[model samples]
Target: MITELKNIKKSFGSTDVLKGIDLTIEDGEFVAIVGPSGCGKTTLLKILAGFERPTSGELLMDDALMNRVPPEQRNISLVFQSFALWPHMKVKEQVAFPLKHHRFVSEAFKKQPDVRVEEMLSAMSMSHLADRYPHELSGGQKQRVAIARALSPAPALILMDEPLSSLDAKLRIELRYEIQKIHRQFKKAIVYVTHDQGEALAMADKIVVMNAGKIEQIGTPQEIYYYPETPFVADFVGKANLLEGTWDNDQFSPALSPNVSWHFPKVSTSFKQAGLCPLRPEQLKPTADNQHGIEVEIQNVQFQGREMIYTALANETQLTIVSDADTRIQIGERLLVGT
Candidate 1:
């Protein structure tokens, strides 16, 4: 199923939450909406799920206008951050609820909801907790049951709003893989909303970065990480060092450190004359020989498990470098830093 959102705008009491969002989700694509709190990622997802109507613009599902469609009639399932499981219902009962409510069961299985429930639970590795209540299950198990329920109706699309936010780090990682597995198994279009950039980078086929109710950039993870179109996206989507500078003669000279200049491999005359130059931490490296490198003083060193993060100062400019942990570097030492 293809879903297109054209010039979507939403406002409440003069506060605009979504500003002219135009996005499309192809069949079985995993798209992630990522941004900081109040950036309107969730608001955009609600528009697609039919929970909230846009103030203007169109929502089309496979060429059919869906702006006025109710959430229940949208053929979409939403998995919220809070699990939203029935406290009194057992695991199997919770999974079967949607099937019974929507009459999704076939004629052969109309009388046996347990058959479908068991199949879903087993697929999610939650069959052992079938008879357990929400209170009796772990956080991860409850989330799995919630997913099972959302998939029970076999909806054409799935919307997940930070579904793994409540779990611990390890459980969150584990469930992320499970969610991807389920998405592949169901072959349904998914729009996942999260504030975590790592989650979006690790799971999504396409990542949409939003800032202040506007879409800053939308692309594959590699493009978003390495070729961000805007300053907001470059800084928000990954660890980037933004150097404000003026472009002149195929070189970018940092305004703060006028003596430091970086040569652009391919300078485009049409590019902005004054803008921020983005460099990832991993892009900078240490050089013992200062012949042609930017001289910088090591301010601090942090030894991570697999790599070392060195904070250095180039005149007044602070730079972060990720290097091998085995590299011998000390605080107060002077070294040449380069790309």
Candidate 2:
């Protein structure tokens, strides 16, 4: 393991921000911490960067205790959400700042400091803006410079606290790909904190879903989306329609409409009682010829480019469904819903 946070806890006066967060990051692994606002994800990232000390538990980096280590001596780089760049420094100077502070000398000392700065800026496609100050650069350009500075130090670990959240939609997508490319080139362990689930699903090798102050689940993107361990995770990670029902005889019967039930051939016998059955929006299909399916009325329809979102009502239960845009369905129409 490259870094391990063992039972870490943090509190501010009477408010508990992090409640015993335990996570591990391997060498060159990209791990994303995702949750809603005020969930302590940023606080966890700060703790890793040594900006905030934990209330209890241990922080181990390569088997060395880092509880008392300062942010400067931790050998970790942080890229903030706001892109903290000095206003007076040019792009070249900003990228070379960390290298100069750490007294980095190139192998054989053959290249000048400006030469190294050019290489970094070139990698981020910012070489053309070398002499530009922060005020002269766009939001995306500033973000690129911030990333270049963070990577110039050659740190073992990098902590990014929602670095792409401040950019526009198009710029966010562009910078996200750039960050992923940089990670592949540098092979540094990265811990990224973000509230956007789509970003986490697209980029993270392992995802950590947190709620309130504790971790709800940690797994690969496929596992987190398909087999959520909790109802909150099922609803938060993706669009899932949770049906409150009773399980018996290898079938789930919704409590609101006991006459309608879904057959599950693989359900365990222990859970043959009351529980929630989570079904993805894409899993629910509307059929016109299935007589055994539940009858529902289409309440609303929305066109979403590639797919159509439908809201339906069945025995007072509202359910959402996603189907191909070519699907022939309309509002105020009665249809059969099946799995």
TM-scores for all candidates?
0.92, 0.92
Task: Indicate the worst ten consecutive residues by lDDT in candidate 2.
Answer: 102-111
Q: For model 2, what is the alpha-carbon lDDT of residue 268?
A: 30
Task: Tell me the spans in candidate 2 whose CA falls farther than 4 Å from its real position.
Answer: 103-112, 256-274, 288-292
Q: Which pairs clash in model 2?
A: none
Q: State the TM-score for model 2.
A: 0.92
lDDT digits (tens) for residues 1-339 of candidate 2: 389999999999999999998889999999999999999998888889888999999999999999888887787888988999999999988988887665333453234767777777888999999999999999999999999988887788989989999899999999889999999998988899998999999899999999999999999998888777787888899888888878876678877567777876643333344387777899889765443377889999999999999999988889999999899688999888878
In angstroms, the error of model 1 at 56 is 0.5
Candidate 1 lDDT over residue span 1-339, tens digit each: 899999999999899999999999998999999999999998899889888999999999999999998887777888999999999999988998888766334554457777878888987999988999999989999899999998877778889999999999999999999998988887888899998899999999999999999998899999899877776787798878877777777677666555666776543333335466787898878765444367788899899888999898888888888988788689999877766
True-structure RMSD, every candidate = 2.5, 2.6
In order of listing, the candidates' clash counts read: 0, 0
TM-score of 1: 0.92
Q: Report lDDT (Cα) of residue 266, candidate 1.
A: 46
